[model samples]
Target: MSGGLAHRWDLSAAAAIALQKSLAGQVERADRLGPGGRRAIRHVAGVDVAFEEGGAITRAAVVVLRRADLVTVESAVARRPTRFPYVPGLLSFCEVPAILAALTALSQRPDLLLCDGQGLAHPRRFGLACHLGLLADLPAIGVAKSRLIGAHAEPGPAKGDWAPLMAPGKTGGRMMRIGAVLRSRAGVKPLYISIGHRVSLRTALAFTLRGTTRYRLPEAIRRADKLSKGGAPG
Candidate 1:
């Protein structure tokens, strides 16, 4: 649980190349199973992290949603003074610790974990969501607000229009992969859904779309966003 070992596959620098190369192979290797049987999705978890005092203290919150209905089931929060630098692609080093602290405090395990960040769409293909999902050994998806690394057109206003997101790299060649197109209450935003640990790109997109009430952010990420900053569920 220290690093991203959720798929039961521990990723070292040897396995995950730097940004100059493609990292999708490393991810595809770790992914063993696909989406399991469809249930009510009994429990869903959202994780978010915030920084205070110019990123000195990191506060993280985890909110669990009900499968029957998107209601709050369990919640936990933890804070710690961060020591990692604000590296662009190495964000997990700073945020993951705080998130891990919060996850450790959770009372129950969630069936699906949604994160307000990217998944395999990273230079090393190991973004925050992928790292946490792998560490927790749970089903998870990465839903980011802004573009991290990919090329795509604007999705339709109706909903469910998607395109492949290509991770920028040269040596590893093409990094194009599937993502989601969503119409949230706020507006239309393209969500990059990727397999974190136990979930697939398609399944991740479906659950993310289902969790949305009226926002570009998914239910799990939405709740996590507010909770991380100590805000009430909107």
Candidate 2:
């Protein structure tokens, strides 16, 4: 085991079949709403990671914001030397450890974890948000700036207007969750969202909308992303 199996993660090629069986039930543990279902909160946190030398060096930053007034409470950063190669589906392998490290150092923990990546919308149903949420045991959602996988329709610019993300069979809801929303604009691009841990699709969408103001991505991700590039890791 790579000790990366903390979530009881299934990484073994031989155990692939068994792992899929086990994950089948766990993925939709949210009952009618599914695993990620939670109300949008005033106190929210953002996490972002940056890599240098072509992802060889990584920096992770986390920021806690008050939903009541949108003020920063706690912020942290973690830097480390990346060991994993830059594979498309395995981004969590490089970012998760540093994100977890930054989360641990937060003095004031936010109610939600807003990550700068994808969640259940991956081939393995294990993206950055899924990895961090499961590890933190908290409500987390992914807000990726780019498309790692799956296909979707164009949404409206008014925000809250989203089209169904096409996923085949069991993986259908992996990208869109159940009621998750995707917003699109002419100049600005749309973002992909999914329940990471204990959150619901409705709540995830609500939070995503609320956190966003005058920008495509939410503040949490925006700040962490900037700090992660050259800023010191906490």
- For every model shown, the clashing-pair count is 3, 10
* TM-score for all models, in order of appearance: 0.80, 0.79
Against the unseen true structure, what C-alpha lDDT does each candidate score? 0.68, 0.68
lDDT of 1 by residue, 1-234 (tens): 333443212244343334213433444313333225344467888888888888889999889888668888788889988866666666666677778778888776677778877887776677777777766666668888777776776666655656667654535576556344344434565677666766778777677777887777767677788888888744
Model 1's lDDT to the true fold? 0.68
Q: Alpha carbon lDDT of residue 210, candidate 1?
A: 79
Tens digit of per-residue lDDT, candidate 2, span 1-234: 011336433345435334434443454324122223444465788898888777777778898888776677778888878766556867776677778778778875567788887777776676777667666766678777777767776777767777655565563444333223378333467788776766666667777887787778887777777777765322
- TM-score for predicted model 2 compared with the true structure: 0.79
Q: What are the clashing pairs of model 1?
A: 6-134, 185-214, 185-215
Q: For model 2, what is the alpha-carbon lDDT of residue 52? A: 76
Those runs of model 2 whose alpha carbons end farther than 4 Å from true positions after fitting are 1-42, 171-181, 184-187, 231-234
